[model samples]
Target: MQSPPATAPVAAPPERGTSPRRAAPRLVGWLAAAWLGPLLAYALGVAGVLPVVVLGLTAALLRGGRTLLDRLVLAGALLLGAACAAGLLFSAWPWGLHPVPVAGTALTVLLGVAAATGRRPRLPRPVPADLLPVAAALVAAGALAWPYLRAGDLAGRLAYAMTGEDNSRHLATVEGIRAVGGYLFADPSAAARIAPEGMVWYPQGFHLTAALLDGFLRSSTAPAGPASTLDHYLGWSLGAWGLLVLAVTWAANRLAGPRLDLPRAAALTGALTAACLGSELARFVVYGYPGESLGLAATVLLVALACRPVARTGTQLAVVGALCVAVGFAYLMFLPVVAVLVLAWLVRDRRRLRRRPAVLAVVALLTAVLAPLPAVAGLLRTDQVDNVATGGGVFPRYDAFLALAGLVAAGLFAGGLRLPVWRRYAGALAAALAFAGGFLVYFRALGTDPRYYYGKTLHLLLAVLLVGAGAVTLLLPAPGRAAQSRPRAARPHDRAAESRPRAARPHDRAAESRPRAARLRWRTPRPARALAAAAVVLACAGLAGLPRGTGIFAQPFDGRTMTWAAAWWSGTQARPGPAELAVRALAQAPAEAGVVTVVVSDRRREGYLATLFVATLQGTHGASGPAVYRLPLSEPARSAALVERVPGRIRFVAADPAAAGIVEALLAAHPDLAGRVTLQRLR
Candidate 1:
């Protein structure tokens, strides 16, 4: 295979010429490739034509004598086409019986290995100076927007976890493990029966971390409940925010070309796309569902690490192990995807592997061993084996539109089809196939009313596709040189003497050199600026009406609200001591005299939990027993009625005494209780 020489800057088309538009046929062809490529591949696989299609594409490309990059791209496109064809062709066949495509994939891997044998060029390493700020902005966006979107039912979930409901379950398992003093796996059947909803299917690693954190916090502060409410927010924030940063940064780096520019815009757009795709996953976290978030986060990290071209052996092993653990914990379907990625990586760098095959082998072994731990535990302890088998019949419909849109978005953003690297092509192809297969599996697992499954899977696939596309688009093209006022096709003899090649022969000489900074400064004149403005306006209009007429801030209490709430909560109770003590004092009060009415401005459950923790710590019977009326100041008559009915039973009402009518009403309604009420300012 003849590799293409290092890319030389191409002269820009003359300014007077009209810009070339994609031919209508070419547009249709590309659209068809996007939409029907998988389907055609699946059909061929079913008809036993996969081999023919692969060989034909490969032969055709080879015959064309295209550059090595083109050949590599063609190879990947063929493999992807084959996988999709096989999927469709064997749609009715069981996964096990579909052998042709599997064999074809194996053959593709072998070819990839053979092709990578020669000397490979090294790309520049990405610098933190270029990456960190973009990453930070993406993380900030997630943090800022998370709180508002996390309110209502979502807040209740976090509140439940914070109060220790979810953590308590995990802790019980952990305590059991500690009691046994080894890796004492719980009974899967019993575990499943009592396992917190949404977590029953997940592995233990992620939950184990949460449990450990809860234990430490409890030991230190002895919060009233089994879990800390803060744990929910912290867990969600960390997992979601972390994934967003990693994914968006990866995408931005891919899009920003070797030098990062104002990558914030691309990062933000990519983040939004990812958020939309993973919205359900986000909701799962807010509802105190850590299992899904944990699994999803693990998957994201695993994919990110796998995407790295050069990694330490140890890092690769660690990533493999983590991925295995994540798959074991989250979903079994992930195993095949992980397998394909690792195999592809190995194929791409077989020479490196020959030097240290043991590392890869060890990673494979650990992955196999550790990944099944949770599944084994389930098998031994319960009927999960049968459950998994029975559940196999459930299949969700794959949203063709979303998948197409995601592919287009990914293509546009990452320039996946445009990249010259074989590894990049392989990675993109693998991702697309994995997504399609995973969706098929997911659909199968949904059984009935697969629409919900479609919704969930559509978001996930779109995120993956868009991120992939965006990264590809950014990295493929090198920066353009600054435009000069020179006339087109000027005679080489008229050019400056220094601009001429020093070498005697054309092939032996390098192109005219320009500083990287100078090259980056090149801007297309007036027409380009006008086009960019038009594009921006169109983009803004499109965003304003995205998801079928929804506004940009259409979702209720989106990221903005969540961020504000989280910030406010963080600021008000920077330390939990005062709030903890206050709740304890209230909890110590007598119950029959009625409850301790703690009036707080925020209606979130975290606030109530904080109040309850303080009351419980103070040895207040009302805090633990009953009659604990933790009313929001927003509710007036209810607060008044509780005080009126309880009278002397109301020992203390915690409130911001300086507040307006609500405080005045409380003071007037229960003057005796008001004297006993402690005015504690969070600040």
Candidate 2:
């Protein structure tokens, strides 16, 4: 029999430390670093030092003698520390501030420890080729799972776009780019008119993309009224979304390598994608919610770049770090998270720190380069401060307790593997308590309807659980080395080697025969198990309640009335005709003629038709100097009185061609102004 391929050599354990294993100091220090770090950073504006303190403590506990695992941990820590320092510097530096004193102090201690123990370590091996296929499968699974996971949010976004109410602002942005040749920043006046008055709260990156598309589309088309192209908008939105997914998948694959098997990778990617698509972050990309996604993506990429091998030069590292910090300025949530994650890395990877001083320097340079623009913008704009403060109303103070508890639970569960089963159970119980406490605190603090908060909490919890489950599943034990090398079937000699007594031979035979029966029993139960699963799924579906009607599934193109109107407009190559002409004629009329009254069938002055009329008049003749009044012909006497108020000016009555006959009847009843009024079709 062949021996199992020699198991990859496990790294030798580090030598035992002489110091007593006292839990109190270590636990207290960890809690302080985790809880107090952010507060200190916020207050002092020096965020990089806390992580160094944490790293020093961790190193002291772990460093009796170096092992390969210790070295790897040290490398990871250095990378993290460097990222934190870089982010803080970049975030604050543009204001002409330096975080260098804090960073320098941290670094001096780290280097001193490294110099005393003086040992250089090599980088880990490149990702294995065999793992590529597993990564591809994982990414594919995530993409496939995305739509199902995000059905509700996707449906809502589509509905919002189809309504053509607030959507017009999105359309106008696209149109303005085509017509005026610049984004909103370039032509503030034009943009201000087209965009909703308070839309600055929305993220600018997605809208900026829309503007770019408009410019591209406009080069081919003539000057038009509004951008009504649905296909174009959908294509651009989805394309950007697809790119985000691809980028995240690539990053995950790079970070985790073959250790992240297909199923685990898929679960992680799917959860992340679902979170992005369904959370407030998606609102940033979809409804132009504003800078959150840009900041998040930037922060993640910066960490990834910082974690890259040290063969790269300081200039290259600085460029990557700068971009990260620049993008982070777009949203504030990323800053603290980025800081914590990086600090965590630094504590975990000390040895790498000594070898790559240049990494720290590059991070500092990048942070210096990228942090100022937003800080300056924030200082100049009081409204920005008000908006940020208003958003804080949703953040409940108690949620911090919950978050802290959850973090502690996760850490304990991960590190407590060597404990007894009851201890493991206790760790799990602690985690659950933390989660519950956090969830309830957040729920009450947000002050929204409980149902809505519950939904949000459910989604957040699901994402957390999915990631946790995936990580655990991926790390579960595989076959032991000896078992892996064994033959599929037992030989007679193997049975003889057991040296069983003759009397026990029959029992052995009976046990051997039982294996077949067990196999058969397993096969027999599968169908029942499947049926039970199907029944449970059906019951859950029934409890959830299905949405009623074709309306739920309806797409934008399903609105036949709107489709017909669009088709007619496109088919006619229609220029605005009589209504527009009448507006121009009225504007050109002498001041004594008074305001022109253009009577249309609708009561609402800002319906789709009314908006079109207003846009056309503006496009053709600039807002007609004489106010054009819209009087609804549905009320004939009132319409007549309004027309009489503007007697000498052209009294143009326009109605949908289909509604003209009804209008004519009303006109026939009113003889006094009938001769003066001109009826026109608005087909």
Candidate 3:
């Protein structure tokens, strides 16, 4: 709950309002600021609900005279919680879960009933000064996010969101959601029911986004294909990630305690964004881990919300409960993350918080812990795998950026030891880093083949360290001598002195006659100097360690991480290659509610073609439920005896020409498939 410093320096009043000639840049600036909200909505796929939720929060925020940090916390938590909860609820309703409906109805009733009981909404106080810096940051964040898409596939290219590491599953899951299309989360829930781990029950807000976006594209005149997916991503998801970075930056700096001014807060954001790409988590994006991205954003948001003054009212409890369900439904790990935040919050202010809002705080904590019970139960039902501890590589290969980032962050922290940040947040910062280390140790101790566990900690550690550094750097000493204190001759009224006939004030003629540069040599203004340094820091913070090479920012998406992905746990197993895209001929062939036995004889890629076949079929419309049987193509791969044992009621065959001939010879020999089997040759 550390508050960011208030917008520190107010702008000096201008002599007059701007004229029309200078208005275009200001308009463009406002337009950029306007894009921030939609960027987050598109990223989370809450466009349908986000605007409404934003209106509600805005109304409440104005009534309460909320700070920009507080407003963002409220808006982010409220929107994410509502959208994800609705998704989970609709998806779960088919299984007879009343969580969403019950909660929604109860909340609606409470809103009305409590209207008469709660305090009347207040008229908001106008505070333009406080809002200006926040406005600038919003536009700045949008500006930073803008360039990433300019270099994307939007111009002309064929691709799916196949760039990220786990995007195969992530993108497939999104299509799977569409493939099982129904009322909102209901279809998504059905998907979850089929394969909770792979497709269904994970954090699905991003999927919901996909659903919303894809549904729109489906209805539009836009071309349909993988290239369309690229368009959607470039137009939306890419910018959304940028917005997420900005939102997290705001939350992190705000969490550092409220004295953070806009420039420093922005510095912290830049620093944090730079580290995000370099962190082990970058692997998730490189690998296409959709859930991890959403979960991480939620974690930052939950932490941000913990800073909101804890309240004990039916309405507060209801909202918190909704958010808990959303977090669990979106990504269950975040429940624990929020739980830790709750524990930390309670622990930090135990003496002070014990008095008034104790019961309410407990309610909030219990809500967070218990909200994900259904998901936890589902996870428990799955068989567990215990991996014996084997160590992982330190700093990881190809992540030299991580090493550079760590050095920079450490230096920043160390360099600022003389600053006040150490006095207030040194312990909290240490605790966060320690907690991150502890996570690594605990997981590495369990040695459960860490997919993303250790790296998540690195992300957290980097962000915390950057916030500490930014706070110190931004908290520069107050301007010296010449006085933000209004020194004599340079006062606002001093301009009026020119009209007075004070005999040219000694050397005024010489000063006026001097070269423009020479006359102003000693002016050395503090504001420009401070702001110029801050601007350079901001640029470096935003651009440093970003993904480099041909990408929009520094990070190139799919190609850079392919090397690491090849070594990933699932890289070798049933991993699809180019064959999936090559096998479109079969999609046009007749299919039934049965299994497809694929025999791919491309010796250059053996098991890889089979993997492609399975993933491609799973992605086929109305085939999400299909059972895939992989048959490696060889003389021995086809067995006439095995043809009779195929389990599907209606069988289909899809294979390369040689494999098709092999399958045809086998079927000719046995004739067991009868009319129930269909065979289509793949190109």
Best by lDDT: 3
Cα lDDT tens digits, model 2, 538-589, are 4322321211111111113234321112222222212233334333332432
lDDT of 2 at 557: 26
RMSD of each: 20.7, 18.5, 12.9
Output the worst ten-in-a-row residue range by lDDT, candidate 3: 7-16
Per-residue error (Å), model 2, residue 66? 26
Which prediction has more favorable TM-score, 2 or 3? 3
Write candidate 3's Cα lDDT for 1-683 as tens digits: 44222321111222224555685575456445445544454455444453444345333432121344443445446555655545544444442222223223323432443233332222222332234335434553344333333434332111223333244455555655554542223454444422224344344666655554455334321224544543454344443444346545655554443223334444455555544443444444344555555655555554444443323233334444555655565556445545555566556556655564755666666565646754665465532122212335344333443544454456335433433223334444455557666766776676654544455555555544444444443234322334223423222111212234644321123334656655445334657655764775555544443323221123322445322222222232222343343334334443334444443343444423333333433444223223322333334343343345454443334445666666577668657666656566655
User: Which segments of model 1 are wrong by more than 4 Å?
Assistant: 1-202, 213-241, 251-281, 311-314, 330-333, 383-415, 418-447, 451-460, 471-477, 481-521, 524-683
Each model's lDDT: 0.39, 0.37, 0.43
lDDT of 1 by residue, 376-484 (tens): 7566656654443332232222353344355445544443334333235446445655665565665567554333333434434444444443343333233244222
Backbone clash tally (model 3): 24
